[model samples]
Target: MIRKDRAVVWGRFVRTRSGLRHHHPMTRKIEEAQPTWFRLSEESWNEIREAYRNGATAKELAVRWKVSPSSIYRHAWEGGWSKKRSADADARAHAEAIAEEERADQTRPDPEAGLFGPPGADDEAMLGDPAALAEQAMAASVRAMRARLFVEAEKLARLSEAYGRMAEKRGGPAVTIETIDLETLYDIVMNKDGRVGERFRVDPDDPGPRDPILVRYWSHRYAEREAFKEQIRRVRANARKAACRAVGLDPDAPLPGF
Candidate 1:
């Protein structure tokens, strides 16, 4: 049993009905009673420690627990609590964000993408597969060759148009001189009165021909057209070879019986 108005220095003194008496649970004398206002229970201290550990500030804890911020501060100081800098935390978060951005970059589309092509552009994945890469390489090479061919064809058309304009001015008929893509087209055809000194192969395989068309319709321009045949042959070599082989015609032996 306990009595009221008893000073409890660990409950060491009490005033009875007869007189004041001395008592100690452990026989130790305490001069002053523990101040109840400043003291806290083990359960309450445990809660405070937990709240501080889990990111509670002194002001936050003070308001929640109905205590002074000073008290909360004192408790935290004794418990050795500290809050990490907000900047440091933000930096770490941004570092993770940058890492994620790099991972996405692995598949990000390049604006200047070409040469081979973009991944999955046409039944070809541009990653980690040798056979698909080889096929795309071949396709890119073919595209380049065809592009050059188209450019050459456009140039040839321009030259032919120039010949047509020249013939209209001279009142002469359109001739085979317009068939060439030569830079010398204008120079050759400007003098049509000269003899046509041009010669060509009767057969690609034989390389034997001494015939000349020494007429008004043939000249250096005609010779140029004959020479241009060799250029055309080179340009169509691959396709012609493929076609010849497909039809059982020897590509190196020229057209048979010609």
Candidate 2:
């Protein structure tokens, strides 16, 4: 119900009559059915940038976007994108933006236990969880012990191999402690005749008596090897105890030996 004094142009209700039906100057523009071109979305902005990178002219983009080139130029300038620019500049700017984004990511506050880490994440947080702490402690202790044992075992293997080879060469199945003295024992195991005494010959033409220092050297080597084996035994025992205690097991309790 429009009053006779009011006229409706488009949605505006002006004075109406039966003879005056279509008389709007702006109606022709609407009648042409122009597509929407205002308030570009972020996706549209990216598309504009992509088009510019692909060397598309502003006129082409304007035609595709249903806007004037002037609008395209204004939006591109404000968005920090350029037209008629070299690909090198585009790539350089892209890399810089990526680096900037990476920097921002590093600065972003990433709280532990947020999604990836275990719950109760904080300094020494594992100490509060007995099970977690025990597991970690046991794992660390076992790793250390295993590494030590690996090195020691390799040394022992080399020593045993050398002793076996030397024993075989000396026509003895094994080194025995049945010799009369330490010097005789060393000589028997070292492939030297024990009966070869000091001044066995009278003349310099004959081979001089076996060097007295050889017995001393072999005796010291034997003592050092025995001591090293004892030390290895004590270290292994302590390592087992420490590992056991770490996992809340009794250190004195019998464990499956490695």
Candidate 3:
């Protein structure tokens, strides 16, 4: 009985020892799997070297070393690692510099802004408001009409003298002068005398009868005078239209065609 009990105790001890030996490698692996921050006793450089040898990435080495990726890159460089990673970093930095320069250029002021001068000044003012521009045009047209009227009046006076002279030379009745409304004036000027010497005249030196020239000149002068008066009438009509428009009246209403 004593021999059998000793055999049992020896067998139990052998089994326990074998089990411990089997679990030892697994325990070492588990310890290795723990985070590097918890395994603080190991040197960071040594850890990096061991991790790199085991095919670890730079980011993994950075985390394990508790340092930046740039630090890992520096160490890799000093240790004669691949230069491709460094070249990639250089290319990235150059790209960033070019992007920054482009952004600055896009934010610069436009060159065209200076050539036309500053906003809200004389250059802008000359464009003129609609009402003021209309008034100025009307005034200029009235002045032109007045000048045309002066020229026509002088011609009419000459025609009156010529008619008196012709009547005296032919011993006939003197020509009559009449005042008529705007409608009659246009009709008479357009239809009278076949637009002969009354409308236009040849130069005095030209080989033509003075009577035909005088008749054509007078006719043309009359037409031109009527046209000038018509323009004045139209201007007045427009002024009235503008006034009516200011007062919210319809500008195209049948007041006059003028």
Q: TM-score-based ranking, best first?
A: 2, 1, 3
Candidate 3 structure quality by residue, lDDT tens digits, 9-70:
32212134334211221122322322332333437576675566456777766554555556
Global CA lDDT computed for model 3: 0.56
Which residue segments of model 2 deviate by more than 4 Å?
1-37, 84-86, 90-258
TM-score of 1: 0.19
> Per-candidate TM vs. native?
0.19, 0.22, 0.18
Top candidate by TM-score: 2
Winner on lDDT (1 vs 3)? 1
Candidate 2 residue-wise lDDT at 14: 25
Model 2, C-alpha of 92: deviation from truth (Å):
7.4
For candidate 1, the per-residue lDDT at 134 reads 46
Candidate 2: which pairs clash?
6-14, 6-15, 7-13, 7-14, 7-15, 8-12, 8-13, 8-14
Q: Candidate 2 lDDT, tens digit per residue, 189-245?
A: 665753544323234465745445565766787799999999999999999899988
Q: lDDT values of the candidates?
A: 0.58, 0.60, 0.56
What lDDT tens digits, residue by residue, belong to model 1 across residues 128-208?
Answer: 444444455556555545656555444444444444454454564444566755645754555443422233223437554
Weakest 10 consecutive residues of candidate 2 by summed lDDT: 25-34
Best by lDDT: 2
